[model samples]
Target: MEKMPAKQYEMGSSTSTKSMQPQKFLHSKRIGHMDSFSRHEMMYDPPSMESKSMPRSSYFNSSKPWPDLESDESDMENEIDIDNLPPIEVGPHEHRLQYTYWLWFSRKGTHRATDYSKSLRVVGRCASVQQWWSLYSHLKRPTALHPYRDLSLFKQGIKPMWEDPANSKGGQWVIRLRKNQIDRAWENVCMAMLGEQFLVGDEICGVVLTTRSPECSLSVWNRTATDHASTTRIRDTLRRILNIPVSVPMEYKIHCDSLKYVAISKGPLKS
Candidate 1:
């Protein structure tokens, strides 16, 4: 096939920065079982004790920094051949995640939205490890996205919007990085989510990734920011998963705050 049409996003325009040193975390239960991602059949089972061991290396290692997404003169230099690359997940399994997730994309920023609902588009949905990897492999990394463009993966029926009932009471943990260095952090965060390492049970709603000049941020949304116990666990788990350094701050914002401020960044940036 001729070289693929020019990709819509461009990465590596600026120097990269390393994330924080991740604290050592004890391994949690391996992802045990789940139902399919079909909208109607979505059901998550209770965590099982029959947890499998996933080598630290299989996912991101808290000990090391992740690779940066950079390219000079060509997209091929940054592209990974999906067909030839090793599978992030191997084969069909007997289990699935508790909920099917849908990936949403939008170049429209909060500034462009006459209607928040109309600005975003659903890219696809996934319920299995293989399925998640397949979807991710086809998409551009967060770093490749233009400033203000965002990618959000939320539970099947839950739109990324704060207005969604499932997310209305919740808040998100934000990880900020330089524009071209978001892929590694983005990958590790998604893997940890898809792997069910948060141990917050079904409290997790989904995650959103957005890029801006000088900063690319990924945020994990959970059901109740008021539930301090669950939210704290989610926050700390995210820190280790993303290997966020202590020097870099992580912000928490209630969905209600978004509605109040009418600016997505305001919620997170508010005190």
Candidate 2:
């Protein structure tokens, strides 16, 4: 037979046999141990406690405890006790609400309004130095009070007005501050009042702040208007405490004069 031309076979020809791939086998875990495990015990048993060893302080070797260490531990226990204890319910008085009195009047009017009055008002102690601060901090600032409000911290029972028996024969050492000066003047005066900086402490009845259309003034009222020594001492002391200029004169208006002016203004007007 004549040799026919050899046919060229292409790579990946259909005539080529397909290679067989090896199969993978998965082995089962041993079933022998499965019978030993108990699901209920595994799920339900309590966890083991953490292995924290007791400190040297807890060791029973020593009969007495170290003072410093014991104190710290006691403090910690106290803190824990405090934290666990119910919070105390504080009352209004326990919080210490305080009020101050002030005398306010119009120069041209008869009716003067005062925060100081005979009516019983809740006033914290005005006796000691610290008590004064307590009053100041808890009470409203002078400027924050109503325009008609005036604060007078006098010996208890003495009224703030000139008509008071204690104030009848007296006068006031007045310092005039402009409208713009109200805030600073109030602060300075309040500080002076609280600090008890007046020299004639016995002569001083109380302090007053008068608010007017154009200006506001503060005065330290004294029991005796004619007593120059007392007046001079009070004036000098107030000036020093307020750091006012020596040249600035503080006017002394006798309580008598104040009452008279009020009387005349209130008197029936002649037609």
Candidate 3:
């Protein structure tokens, strides 16, 4: 499929055009991790004292524990059942997006440092506009999610974590929004990212919507915090896309600073 020119996404232009035909791109069926409910059921047993004493680094190990491995495989088996769900019909001509994106969900764990990665799960993936809508339509609105829950839409292959290789040297533009503003703001940012409206090329990593008590926040992750020009463009483009007023504060926090904070909070490393 021919890529749509970046010019097509310039400010003030409509995101979609009549000339763009939906190209047939294969949708990846491997949605990572199970839904929160199923995962919670599988992990009902309390953490053992031995497990708690294990080095914190072990929790982030690339290898999965036996029970988690079993649940992961079972979740893969259920992907076949997706076709049975209520159909979200798209015409033969679907609008192919510039890049495939994955949706991820996470809930804060009892331990802030470790629970995050353990709770992270891939909700679904989409390569075209129709598929994105199909996945999104089935999800509860941001307003419905409980506090401490996060919904992120990231480019495929990039995990929404500070330690991920793509994100390790980067930072994010964070914008806090009122409870009532989340739904519209989240949709607008996702559409902007998928449409390549940021114009930062591959520098743009993903967008996240985090729900919290009384307020919610959205963050746009990028590949480099040192590239002032690109980062500035992203911040400006984000403001334009979200139509956020100047009064609403936007905070930029580097991943390294965040890592330092985590390390300090966790205290000295155990031998």
Candidate 4:
């Protein structure tokens, strides 16, 4: 893939692109913790307790619309006697992605005192369709996590924090939603990123999900803060794919300003 030149934003710049790949960005560039005013709209939840020791069905939410994973497929075309049945074959059916991505889990705002660098954990890395689904299926949903926890997804080797080299000059588009709103929106954004449906260049780095008591925010980090054209392209794609209501408000901010002003500032950050 051809690398695109990223736009750099100095400290205190107002212009930034809108995004929702989520945990929050464009507002906390330094990385120990995220500012409330962080920009984004996508959400993810950590793996369920059982997922770690023993993988379980990914769809833990009883309210989930789809049928259970076990019973969806049935009825074979050919029939054979039990005594002489043909042996099954195992082949490589996994679908591959352009980049191997990593999923991160942490409790950023819920326990502000905890060290962000230390708490961030990589659940796993995936480069194939089967691998992605296997990882996602075992994890818990956003609604299942504690209000203070967060989830993030990014390309392998790229940390989701604002201070990471890949994200320093970039910004994100943030989307805020009530606790009840993260389900479908989260899934949509994941699919979009994995599918590379955003239509922009390699500008997108990753996305994050931050959950607080009352609501949560989803943010998508891009590689540039001043590339207005590319940023707008991503924003439009996000808007269309997310089906965000016209009435909902969106905001953009740069990592430099976020790090310099949002973080290390005494004032309370906005969600």
The TM-scores, one per candidate, come to 0.62, 0.52, 0.65, 0.63
Clash pairs (backbone) in predicted model 1:
20-244, 20-245, 34-96, 44-98
lDDT for 47 (candidate 4): 33
lDDT of 1 at 31: 22
Clashing pairs in 3: 22-94
- Rank the candidate models, highest TM-score first: 3, 4, 1, 2
Show the lowest summed lDDT stretch of 10 residues, model 4: 71-80
CA-lDDT, candidates in order: 0.58, 0.46, 0.62, 0.59
Q: Which pairs, if any, clash in model 2?
A: 101-151, 101-152, 102-150, 102-151, 102-152, 103-150
lDDT-superior candidate, 1 or 4: 4
Off by over 4 Å in 3: 1-92, 110-112, 269-271
Better-scoring candidate (lDDT), 1 or 3: 3
Worst 10 residues of 3 by lDDT: 23-32
RMSD of 3: 15.7
Find the candidate with the highest lDDT and give its number. Answer: 3
Cα misplacement distance, residue 194 of candidate 3 (Å): 0.4
Off by over 4 Å in 2: 1-125, 179-196
lDDT of 1 by residue, 49-120 (tens): 232232222332222222222222122322222234232332455346566677776665443454777556
Please provide, for model 4 over 1-271, each residue's C-alpha lDDT reduced to its tens digit, 9 standing for 90 to 100: 1122232111112312232222232122422122121123112232342444432222121222322212213112111122332222222654456677877776554234424665565554566555565577666778777777778999866888778898999998877766666755676577678767776747899888878777777788898888888888777776766665444446776888877864556567668
TM-score, cand. 4 vs. native: 0.63
lDDT of 1: 0.58
Candidate 3 per-residue lDDT, tens place, 1-271, comes to: 0111212121223222221111211111111121111222222222321222232112122233212212435334323222232323334666556677877777665336544666676556676665565555556778878888788999877989998999999999887777766776776678668767777889999999988888778899999989888898888877676655454556787998898787787787667
